[model samples]
Target: MGFKKDFILLTKPYYCVNILLSLSYLLAKKAPGICVYLFTPKESECELDGRETEILFFLAIVVMIRTRKTGSVTMINYLTSSFIYTKIANLILWAYADYLYGVIFGVVFIITALVIPEPTYSGPEHVTYFRTEHALDDELESDKRIVWIIAFYTVWNPACVNFAPIFSELSAEYNLKNFRFGKVDVGRFPATGKKYHVSDSSLSRQLPTIILFKNGKEFLRRPCVDVKGKLQTFFFSKDNIKAAFILNTLYKESKENGITTDEKKQK
Candidate 1:
């Protein structure tokens, strides 16, 4: 249920905006006279004799601004708000034009509202990492069967941004019941950085540290320091990570525990 709600929240804004734009364009093209009557603020205020197209364009902009301000982008909110606005505009048009035109406009609004589909929701399929230190510690301690691979990253670091897609792909490919992948934004949670010895300062050199934990203990890590104690940033690639950690450490552990490749393939 939580996943369903998240998916709806993430996707509804785009869908609603698209539907509003398309409907506005269709109305403008098909019913220019009606638009000029409905959208023009006051018939006596200005002369819209030769500016029908301009009025329609500005009308679309007005609808868009109202939708944005509402901030609730669900289909129901958009349709209800749009219907009320359209009804008010049509009332104004009716005072100037025939009552039949107002009825037509109301019918059009109702049909369009009914035709708009509610946005669909789908949850993410892969494992995700928590952000805070306590969450990470609790997960590690409570689940002895889960081996965690955590990437400690800072938002300002361009290297971390570049490596994000690679990390995500690896997570989808290699995640298992006993092995999982996640990341922490050290920029957001500085205490998490300090706990893992990840420097959050902009001037500090070390960033994007990847750590492995098994049985609630630190197992291995990337970007080891040099002889002078200066941190080294290793090139983060899928093949490098797979070879260094997945095949070498994780696969070995899985094999020892009788979690064979054939069983994983069947799952």
Candidate 2:
């Protein structure tokens, strides 16, 4: 019930402003009790104002762009808070002061956010790392055989570093304590790279390849090979990975199989 209330309150800007100001007051060694009176010259002036409407409109645009994203309440909350906070600052410094200032400030903030680093995530994870090819093989063919969505990556690849967070967040949600995520450092084990047909060289197109293993065998791999043995191009975006891997189906199968542990050793 407490979580639900807080969740609903997340969408309310008036309360958010009050809390923010109160925290700021406390930080500055001032009494926060007085901060509640902010933007409230009259006690009953608590209605959805033009400032909030403006902020919410832009917020709607941000949300719409991420419609395909599922799971990760942390991602949702961080985005909501950051965008609202930026808009609130924009409203105070420009919008409320002058009509034209508001328009310019709003656009600037949105553009700036697009380039800045997003919030850091330190949440759930169920990824397994294999040191050698032998270790990786044993786990995949183990008695408690289940789905394994493995990421074959090299440390030197910039694309793999960028994809790390996306992979971790996905594991936090869909992996569900099942060790569904596996990582193989093809940089360290080049033989493993050849075994999986992933190349680790600097100019290689398959630096960070995602493969799905099921029923103790390889099931699907992105940048899927054609019948003629040519590798097709694949975009490694989060949406593309989800769709190509059919994460939703894999997640469902994990539940149906009653996978209570990540590995046989854990059992």
Candidate 3:
């Protein structure tokens, strides 16, 4: 399960960076060598110490909390955050053995936070936007020959935001008459989420759930519950999704049939 995408990428990089920088004002200690080298060697304030570390660490926690309190993952976001969390955690573990690991992680985190860019996508995807539960249900039941892939998402969930571009890319790449793509923003339409058993909560493990529909019925869904009812983690990646949904096979089959611009003539 995502669990806010394994508890990372819940906060926007800018938001977290801004918080840390603003909090730096309270630090009256000396900056670490990394910080001094990056910015000012002659530091009057904004230092690093045990208590200061506590505050900054707490501040990092604040980034996570605030992002979650507000909203987590994507293929890019998921991959990036996964790497970050793994490195940071491993750094902590190795830091217990030697201090170098901690130093490296601190330097990198500080540097990355300073220069990390925020998402700036503002275009629309080439997928049908389902605005209501009734419309979704009707569309699903309306066509049996058509295969549908739907992304269940929310506005505040970073995981969804990250996957948003990938989803759009897939739709554009795999556009076909028999094969279609769609999205439902559970944030805007809570009833649709409730009807589909997907939660719109920021902490929901299935915020960016993807399901395949065929013959007016659900054929497959990612992050599905296991035999014990525990949700399984589904990594969002183009290759992963293509294989999981058998996009190549479907694409070939749909391509065999012409792209149906005139549904009337075909039906």
| C-alpha RMSD values across all candidates | 13.4, 11.4, 9.9
Q: What is candidate 2's lDDT per residue for 1-267, written digit by digit as tens?
A: 147744665555544543443233223223333323543445344344676456556655655443223121343333443444445544554456457756765665565456543434456777889997777789876744677888999876655654677788788878654437889999999988899889999877775789888777888997677899887866566687889888887788778765554555575
RMSD (Cα, Å) of model 2: 11.4
| lDDT tens readout by residue for model 3, 127-180 | 999986678888887777888999999976767766777788899889877789
Query: In candidate 1, what are the lDDT values of residues 43-110, reduced to their tens digit?
Result: 34333333444544565676666544433244434453344454445444443344675576557656
Model 2 clash pairs? none
Superposition TM-score, candidate 3 onto the true structure = 0.64
Give candidate 1 misplaced runs (Cα > 4 Å): 1-127, 246-249, 255-267
Residue 201, candidate 2: Cα error in Å is 0.9
**On TM-score, who's better, 2 or 3?**
3
lDDT for residue 73 in candidate 3, whole number 0-100:
32
By the TM-score metric, which is better: model 1 or model 3?
A: 3
Assess each prediction's global lDDT (C-alpha) against the native: 0.61, 0.64, 0.68
TM-score of each: 0.48, 0.52, 0.64
Name the runs in model 2 displaced over 4 angstroms.
1-121, 177-179, 261-267
Candidate No. with top lDDT: 3
